[model samples]
Target: MGISNILEPIQIGSMTLRNRVLMGSMHVGFEKLEDGVERLAAFYAERARGEVGLIVTGGAAVCQEGGMGDQYCNVYMDEHIEPLRVITAAVHEAEGKIALQLFHAGRYTNQDATGVESVAPSALQAPINRHKPREMNATDIERTIQSFADGAVRAKKAGFDAVEIMGSEGYLINQFLSPVTNKREDEWGGDFTRRARFGVEVSKRVRAAVGPDFPVIFRMSGLDLVPDSTTMEETLQFAVLIEQAGVSALNVGIGWHESKVPTIAMMVPRGAYVWVAQQVKEAVKIPVIASNRINDLRQAEAIIQEGRSDMVSMARPLLADSQIVRKSREGLFDEVNTCIACNQACLDHIFDGKIASCMVNPVVGREKEWALIPAEVSKKVAVVGAGPAGLEAARVLAERGHQVVIFEKQNQVGGQLNYARQVPGKEEFNETLRYYRAQLDKLGVEVRLETAATADSLSDEGFEEVVVATGVIPRRPEIPGVDLPHVVSYDRVFEKQAKVGRRVAIVGAGGIACDLSHLLVQDQVVSPQSAQYLLEYRILDAKAVHHLQQSGRKVYMLRRGKHVGTGLGKTTRWAVLANLKRHGVEMVTQIDYKEITAEGVIIRNQEEEQLVQADTVIIAAGATSNDSLYHALQGSLPVHLIGGAKEAGELDAKRAIYEGAAVGRAI
Candidate 1:
């Protein structure tokens, strides 16, 4: 894992980065807080101190119409410049360069959020957005181009090292470039050349406003991932033109926000979109940044060393581990907390108008508040359970100079994550366990595997405080014939202890059921390497690839509710359900559980009884709190119940980890 090209410094125009890693822009929901700029300053400074090559702030709207919401900073407002200076100054004080991303959401804007109708190249509505944007008149186009230029000028005044024009992800400039969105007959549309003019003009104007010496990076879509969208040839054409327009670098992004493709999900292979960036790199003279799903330094190194792209952009990975670069540079690869791409806390929260945080690293935006200083009085603590909650609590407590011990009944850590890792395409769950194990070891926390500690035992061992994070137990339904040998729990199936038949019926279509269904129906696990090979060489046609994706298994998910996969996050639910449908997994909802028979699951839907044929039945009927330890040790010693032991609503690891860390800090 020795890094070469990734760790090497590279020059983008006048800006010489310390390394080739760019902390890419992400909408972290910090800009709307009362002390938003201060929070952002601390956030960026921490990452800068971690030795990231360069930092790009989340998109700052150039105009009001282009603004994502009030939460996003607008460079058009003069009052915003001084506050943004705090961010650049903080990063500069940490000896790191910061870039301002000038953005225009265009048709992607929510009318309620912006208090204005969205605008696009044409009147075509974005599928994701509710309202159709008004077609831009001649004046609106000219004004928007000017807004970008003005925004760049303000960015320079705010002491930013660079400005990246946000042309990608179906934004204003990208809208004009794509024929699907730009159904216009004006000078801005009709053909590819005309369609590409807006982005080129924006880049040209921004470059002129920023001056020749100032760094100006243009972010463009390498692949639209939408039907009848900009083709690879047209994308390359845009890249070449934008390069000629005087941009210093091109940061290539994949898919629009509205695209059905799961670009940044866990199922997506690491460095999967580097090929798109490579295509752009081949077409342009400027430096190209390979983005989307490039998590670790090893992947970034390979991308740069193999000349796929000049640099790599890792946004969520930085969120998961702020010191990713420092850890990798020191050869402490295992210490690096990798982003699982769950999108549970980050993207899902953002989409829900909640403040974005990290699922793995919960103290992302609260850097100032949750600073882990040494404890005043170290105490001996016993954490029961080695799941996400217990592991995190132990790590934090030990780091704060507390003597900590974790007792896991299982032979290994990652209590429920052990089962989660068994799910197909969810192998990244192992990364979370790996990071926790490394952190626990580094902090000198004693982990007793296969040693179940009773409440009395913990008190007898002289532990002052105990954290009960024993996790949850699967709730078996009250149905007839539940004791059949063919019936199995989801955990048993995940553990490979039960023999699952070809025709399987899953009871309860929650997140776990969906994942189990996916596992049962996945014929073969395609490694990222093999997938890339198949894609690069065109070894499989579209039809053949589609065929290869399916398992052809007969699986039925039975649910008593109206919706399946209800426990999944907003950003991930659709993709998981779509994947299940693609693999031919039948999901039936709003049914009353009749009985679990050896032949199949018998259920009645809409007063119609039906026998769902299956050789094996899996019970994923949700979970209940395993708080027996909490109750037994209520007032014996200082005990805090956390994670599933406290509330097993949906087995949310995000909540568990956060609660664990909070208790650790409190202690």
Candidate 2:
């Protein structure tokens, strides 16, 4: 289908966007560095150059007390104006429009970061926050409202194209909108109308301050996805009020931070929350933008053409590939590095209190430092593996005008990522492979599949630089009857080379084990389209579909360690574990492996021996570095090691890709 709807220009208030793609707001933890403003300006300028229709910057705190942290922009302070002005100028110079997102964390604020306790409409304790908030009095509420108005004034003075009032994702305004958090009987929280007064008043005040021409977008929660939250009717009513309050558009956000539903994980289907935005669009005359899990141009175009939304917002996809919009516009969809939504390097890092970057594109936050400039001197380079590390290294080397070749023993690339894609809900890994293939081919990198390059072969090729990213080999744990006919390695199971039985026992309770268990215990594989159809037609409710998604297969996972899924990211571990639990996969930690019998594996937990009844046993203990090739070529040639070859203690694709890119630049 031809792309037309998403590419169409849109007008919001007096600000006209070149296209419907909005680079959504994301906090990258770059707001408080000494040269933070300069870094941020460069970041936005890159996206602007890529021809994104509009950009809404990360939230800037409306007041000190409601601040996310010291790293966030405090618009309440006089010092913020100059920095914001610099950003707006940079964006405008690139011929792009930018919106400043006025923010307040409310009870989500960290006392350690703000040097004060969090304040909210009521003194409710948030599940995600440690600090119980102090209830805001009438004076506090009035002051907070004034602060939002003042922040809008600051944004306009800074030459911003528009301002987005941050009201969603269980922030300050969302707290007032939800009945679960706001228990106050005062004017602010007596009923639905009163509960929504805070956000409406803020929008009204911001509009009053910015004048009618300036764009005022309210990011309202379409569905809190929490218990006893605002109903859809109330949320739509809130949207109507916000529109009446003089907002130019409504950007619909789904789920609260404390909501159990996974909003932006790899498991979430694309455009999963679009219905929420459609409801808001129908409720109000103003344009509505759908957010969350809508990546790529096809999804965006369909959303706009179908009239479900007037626009679409993509935050992480832009981080993965700043040129997503431009590439799609030129019909170079294959070249665009789609966001896998693994959250390994972006959201996971943010939640870990570290600087955020992209797993695929490592140059995201370090754009200036990690630029792939042309090599001063080009040379013939040999990358001795076609996995993540080798693929990236080859791509970068070829891009810098170096003659590059990649050797892989397998018929295809992606290494362990192939297994990852085989797991349910991990279909996005194929995109990584697709991107690498496109990049390598475009850069003229030679790939030799089913051909493993040895030290002698590489030395004979007369390559100046050799990069050894040989990846890793699964560790074979020592146990009685380990090589039994019914026992299989995780790789064999993933490759379908070995047959799994009705009952299965898996060794090692790590990421691989959990994924394998999920795959084996699931009764049927539901494609995203089919799943959406099931829900849309009401053939099966979410709860019933969830029940049907799993099977009664007896799968047991055994781990020697005390914890399961040890190295998983904090944001994704819980969700993965929940899936395992929901599928009835029994995970036993602190177990002593006795032996592998024909019927099943024997384990001793808490000094009690028991037979885990299983027709097949699988081993997924861990991995060891495949550094034999690296060591072989060490003294024979000048070689660099990366990815699993450098460190196999933890299998990390994020570190692998980053290392490959860094090595490529250095060479």
lDDT of each structure? 0.91, 0.90
Find the candidate with the highest lDDT and give its number. 1
The TM-score that candidate 1 achieves is: 0.97
Q: In model 2, state the lDDT of residue 80.
A: 83
Residue-wise C-alpha lDDT for candidate 2, range 106-208, written one tens digit per residue? 9999888889778998898888888899999999999999999999999999989999999999999999989988999989997999999999999999999
C-alpha RMSD values across all candidates: 2.3, 2.2
Shift in Å, residue 353, candidate 2 = 0.5
Clashes of each: 0, 0
lDDT for model 2: 0.90
lDDT (tens digit, per residue) of candidate 1 on 356-391: 899899999999899998999999999999999999
Error of 1 at 198 (Å): 0.7
